[model samples]
Target chain A: AQTVTQSQPEMSVQEAETVTLSCTYDTSESDYYLFWYKQPPSRQMILVIRQEAYKQQNATENRFSVNFQKAAKSFSLKISDSQLGDAAMYFCAYRANRDDKIIFGKGTRLHILP
Target chain B: DTAVSQTPKYLVTQMGNDKSIKCEQNLGHDTMYWYKQDSKKFLKIMFSYNNKELIINETVPNRFSPKSPDKAHLNLHINSLELGDSAVYFCASSHSPGLAPDTDTQYFGPGTRLTVL
Candidate 1:
């Protein structure tokens, strides 16, 4: 079984600033995937970014990026130039390669301050 | 166009009542999944189907049933809903397993909020 952990329950960032959400997982599998999802007030789950465990290079999607340390079992999400829309409940997820299921961590509520 | 969609964005019903939430994906993906987000915002996979075949069934209560009529549609039916069942349900889809590169990314739908009174 795999488990994802988000140590922070809540986080706040000033608009236009940057914020990093920490995530760690327990998995013995060599091939897997890590993902960060955002659920806004609308309750819609949106994919922020993903990182492949086999790849050492981090994944960056526009203002969103990840710091993936495979050996440390850590995958953190970084939001640059944080916008009001970035305020949401962020969840860290883990999935084994070719596995149909994904395990999610308890979300971290992100607050954007003006 | 919406890649994934769920019907009845909001559902409110009395306890012991039966309800179903429908999900559809137009992404042409072969795998679909149902996830439950409890009040604490912890999301967990409940069931997964690939091409209408059951792939994964978590240790969820038997009252919670998932049905996939085709590769693009997966629906959830809850019997005798309980207060604890009041939570958000999200549907997602992805490509076939082991395809790597692109198969791992799952696209989610706008969750259906189920409120049991």
Candidate 2:
């Protein structure tokens, strides 16, 4: 079974600054996908960024980018120029190509400091 | 146009009762999934279906059942609900390429909040 772990339970970033949330996973499969999802107070889950294990290039979605270390099993999310709208709970997830089931972390509460 | 939606955004029921949550997706995807988000905000996959056929069934209790009449809809019915069952249920869908296993993004619904009193 694959499991995702996010070390930080809470993270805060000053406005216009950068923040990084750490995530690690345990999986024996070589082909998989890592994702970061954001859920606001409305409880709507939004996809932030996704990284494919086969691709060495890290995924970048505008201000959101990821530092994926395949060897270390680390997939951290970095948010640059953080704004107030970025305040939400973020989750790290892992899914195998052959399996549709996704393993998600407990999630990290993000606070944007004005 | 709404892509995926779940009815009864919030539900409160007493213990040992039965309830159902309806979900529908208009993305034309062939696969649908049911997930539960606990109070601590831990999201876990409970079940998934492909064209109204059971694809994946997790270690969830038998009290919880999922029924899919078609590829576009998946409804969850919980019997004798318990306090521990109080959580938010999310419906998602995905479709893969023909004859190959490819990574497809899963679109999630707004989620239904179920509270067991």
Candidate 3:
């Protein structure tokens, strides 16, 4: 079974600064997808960024980027030029090519200091 | 337009009561899923349907049932609900199956907050 783990339960960063939320997963499959989702107080789950296991270039979406290290099974999300809107409960997720369910980590609460 | 939506944004009921949450997607997606977010905020998949066919059914209790009448709708019915069942239920939809690339993004609904007293 594949399991996603977010080591940091809570993270705080000042506005205009940068913060990284660490995540790791245990999986045997080499071909899979990793995702970072943000759930704000509205409880809407929004996709921040995603990375394919076969791609080594990593994935960047605006101020959000993922540092995906396949061999290390580590996928961390970096929020650059952080804003107050970046505050939310961030979740790290994993999905194998053959699996239908997406396994999610415990989640890390991000707090932006204005 | 609302890509994905769920009805009864908030639900409050007593134990042993039966309740239902409806989900619909207009994204023309072939796959739909139901997830539960517990009090501790752990999101877990309960069921998934693809093209109106049952695809993934997690190890959820038998009291919970998922009905998909069409490719765009997936409804969840909980029978004899218990206090433990009090949690926020989410509906999501995707365009392709699990193996397809560029289709892994699942759009979520506003979520139905169910509180079993």
Candidate 4:
């Protein structure tokens, strides 16, 4: 069984600043995928970024990037120049390379302060 | 056009009533999934279908049944819904399971909020 853990229940960052959300997962598979999904008040689950286990280089999309440390099983999301629209509940997910199921974490609610 | 869409974005019904939520994907993906998001914001997979074939079925109650008429549509029918069943249900799709980079990358729907009163 695999599990993803998001330590922070809630986070706050000022507009134009940066913030990082921590995520860790336990899995026995060597090759897998990690993802960060954001759900705003509108209740839409949007994919932010994704990282492949075999790739040493992290994944970056616009203002969102991930610090994927395979050895430590840590995948953290970094939001640069956070905007008010970035305020949402972010969830970390994990899926095996050959599996169809995706495991998700509890999620961390991000708040953007003016 | 929406990549993945769910009908009846909001469903409000009384307990013991039966309801169904429909999901369709236009991405032409071979695999589709159903997930439940609880009040605490915990998302969990409930069912999965590959090309209209049942594949992954979690430990969800039997009252919750999923039917895939085709590769592009998956509908969930719940019987005698309870208060605990009130949550946001999400429909997602992705390519078939494989080693491809986009194999397991899921595209989610807007989600249907079900309220049981």
**DockQ (Cα-based) for each candidate:** 0.86, 0.73, 0.77, 0.91
lDDT of 3 by residue, B1-117 (tens): 999999989999999999999999998888899999998889999998988888999999999999999999999999999999999999999877544556778889999999988
What tens-digit string does per-residue lDDT give for candidate 1 at B70-98? 89999999999999999999999999976
By summed lDDT, the worst window of 10 consecutive residues in model 1 chain A runs over: A95-104
Docking class of 1: high
Q: After superposition, how far is residue B115 of candidate 4 from its true place, in Å?
A: 0.8
Candidate 3 residue spans exceeding 4 A from truth: B98-101
Runs with alpha carbons beyond 4 Å of true place in candidate 2: B97-102
Badly placed stretches (over 4 Å) of model 4 are: none
Model 1 chain B: lowest-lDDT 10 consecutive positions: B97-106
In the range B85-108, model 2's lDDT, one tens digit per residue, is 999999998885343343357889
Please identify model 1 stretches exceeding 4 Å from their true place: none
TM for candidate 4 is 0.98
- Over A10-45, each residue of candidate 2 has an lDDT whose tens digit, in order, gives 999999999999999999999889999999999999
| Cα TM-score per model | 0.96, 0.97, 0.97, 0.98
Query: Model 2 chain A: which ten-residue window has the lowest total lDDT?
Result: A94-103
Cα deviation at A100, candidate 3, in Å, is 1.6
Instruction: Check candidate 4 and list the clashing pairs.
Output: none
Measured on C-alpha atoms, candidate 1 has an lDDT of: 0.93
Alpha carbon deviation, residue A91, candidate 3 (Å):
0.3
